[model samples]
Target: MAHRKWIVWIRRAILLVLLGALVYHSTIVIQIIRFRTINPRMTALMRQRAREARARGQVPKRLQVWLPYERFSPHLVRAVLAGEDPRFFVHHGFDWDQIREAIQENLEEGEIVRGASTITQQLAKNLFLSTSRNPVRKLHEAVITVELEMLLGKRRILELYLNVIEWGDGIYGAEAAARHYFGRSAAQLTPEQAAFLAAIIPNPRETYNPARHPARVERRRRIIQRRMRHVLIPAPFRAASAKAAESAFAP
Candidate 1:
């Protein structure tokens, strides 16, 4: 009986492997047919969340509004890259150097001193997965990050990330965040406002308040300005951005 049970378990394992392979191949074929679409896993999750919200008789609070890359100001994009992911243009989906440094910092501090996610990895997590922190979910994020980067170039990746990332509880995208926070379109957002908006993305739901967190907003704005001066964006754009930033923060 023990021998028969062992053989049965082995057979089940083989069947599971075959099923996994079939699904994997099907996924590849589907992806080939939909190269420009959001990752399938993300679309499914979005639908599931919407369906669950409807089942609970709750309106889904998510607000996603995709815009073309051309709609956003190049300065705003540069500010986001400078603030969030400086190596976005050069790195692949993963930045192992930053990951290693983050791990070391966390170990040394006994707290999360740094984030290990690259822009692509963050985009995958924001679009497809929840805020749950676990090895299994992180592995899935990494896999999907690679797929997204393979299918979309850096420009498209940044554009989609800017458009879909949650800025406040019910606000999403650069356009929405700008309107919600500053009463302006993303194209008209002054550099200080744009920098403050970028600062909030790390913890959008908690960190910012247009009324209450003035000090924190000023500090983050300064950091963004300093970094903006050092890198990203062209020199003329930088000068104009600096001027706008100074004007925005002027009492």
Candidate 2:
């Protein structure tokens, strides 16, 4: 009798867990479908940052300006592609090759120093999820990423990412980053400036911050500039980038 009761309890627990997962993912699907037409006014990271600032007794400041896809410079687009996701245009919502490489590197180094997230995955996490690396959050991010790809195309995804990604302590989006870092608009950023900004995307507040580590940022900027020549933005954007950038570096 006790054995049967134990099995019944286990079955009920499994059903409850499955039911909770269904409800969670169903809500995510509804939100993602709405994202097809609705531009997000704010993102999960913004809210998280605000709460953190409040807990620390520091006022939260946000700098963000939403611009349509065409308003940002093509050079910035190229630089971002070079620095963050070189195969963004080809991949769906994930990059298996990158995952394999990152896994191999982690094994060799005996540490987790690299990430394999695609731009689409990053956008999904920033838009709707927290920065935590917990398994539940990662699973939710995966679901959101798939839904985002199913609902929004590559161009729209890129535009939303460019507008929502955190570039600094209070800076969000290309326009705000440009204004804060270089005293210019997103549309007017030069290739080198754009490259510098892009190189800091992985960790804008510390490792690659120009204020704290200009030398590291500069090295990454040069590497990105070289990669920019080969990186291609998704259409309907033109390909006439980086060639003009070559002149900027001519000595």
Candidate 3:
């Protein structure tokens, strides 16, 4: 009788532990789904209001504003695409070639100078993580990246990235970045201005100061212009894009 009771207790304990784990996993899944599918417009509006409040030296109501893709210029999108991931449209959530190359580079340098994270991976990190660099955080980032890719399509993922990308210390999204960097709307960003913003994505905190880093900005702008000159868009749109970028880093 004693042996049977002990066995029963052990089984019950095992079952309880399994149930607890199931519940925890279910909660995390629910949160991920909600985060991925929540109305983006509402989030954008809230962020915009918060940005305004912060600019006015009032209490910030939110962390960041995320502008929808429509509010951004095609040049902005193209510049980001060219600079970050030229094969963005072709990959699912991970790019094997880039991953392999980054691995090789890391091994050769004995450092982590290159990361092969796709746009989806970047979104997963931006939306869900703090600035902790740990194995646990990296594992979670990968899991969440897969989950988000499963939940959101490529277009939706890109949309989220465009809106959520941190442009400056407090600036978020292309619209805010364009206004803060160039004194214009996102839709008005030209290829050069867009390229300047794109160049800063690698290290936004250190790379994107217009007044203080005029030389660096000019160099990046020239590079972006040179790279994008051959790319084609509509004539009128191209003219407007060129206009916005013409005096992008001008004092």
Candidate 4:
């Protein structure tokens, strides 16, 4: 009798845990749906950074000014696409070719040398998840990525990504980064400047900072400029895309 009762309790506990997980994931889905219209005031990354700052006995500072899609410079858009995801327009939420390439590269290098996270995946992580790359978090990120792609569409995803990407210690968004770094608006950035900005995105706050590593940034900027000339911007950004951005869209 006691063994049967123990088994029943175990099943109930498992059911409760599953129910809780469903509720948690459902809440995230609702938030993602809301994001289709309402821009988030703060993202998961922003909130996490704030918490970290508080833990370190410092005030959390944020600098972000949302710019409409049209307000973003064509050079900036092209540069970002070139630097981050050339196949942004072709892929849904994940770039399988890049994933395979990255896996192969990592295997050859015997280390993680490249990442395959698409713009959609990156945006999903920024908006909803932690900085951790653990398998569980990655699974959740994948789910959220699909939800974002299904709900927000490509143009909206790109807009949100540009508006929320971390550029520096306290900086967020192209508008804020432009103002902080160059004393200009996002729409005013030149091609070279835009490429440089995109080049530093991987670790803009530290490692790849233009202020701290001008030579490295210049090298990356040059590479991105070359790529920008060979990549095509998607339909939503086509009207605003740079002349150099015209290229075959097939991936």
Best by TM-score: 2
**Per-residue C-alpha lDDT of model 4 across residues 129-182, encoded as one tens digit per residue:** 998979989988998888888888788899999999999887999999999989
Models, CA RMSD each: 5.3, 3.2, 7.5, 3.6
On lDDT, who's better, 3 or 4?
4
Query: How many clashing residue pairs, candidate 4?
Result: 0
- The digit string of per-residue lDDT tens for model 3 on 90-209 reads 777788987887688658855343457887878767766645579866776777777777877666777788777777766667777787778888787767778888767755656546
**Which residue runs does candidate 3 get wrong by more than 4 Å?**
1-25, 35-65, 100-115, 207-251
Error of 1 at 133 (Å): 1.3
Candidate 1 or 2, higher TM-score?
Answer: 2
Report the poorest 10 consecutive residues by lDDT, candidate 2. 238-247
lDDT leaderboard ranking = 2, 4, 1, 3
Q: Over the stretch 55-112, how does candidate 1's per-residue lDDT look in tens digits?
A: 9899976665566666675557767876677677778888777778668865885534
Q: Please provide TM-scores, in order, for all candidate models, with all chains considered together.
A: 0.73, 0.88, 0.65, 0.86
lDDT of 4: 0.83
Q: Report every candidate's CA lDDT.
A: 0.68, 0.83, 0.66, 0.83
Model 2 per-residue lDDT tens digits across residues 143-216: 88888888888888988999999999989999999999999998888888989888888888877778998877
Model 4, stretches more than 4 Å misplaced?
1-14, 102-114, 239-251
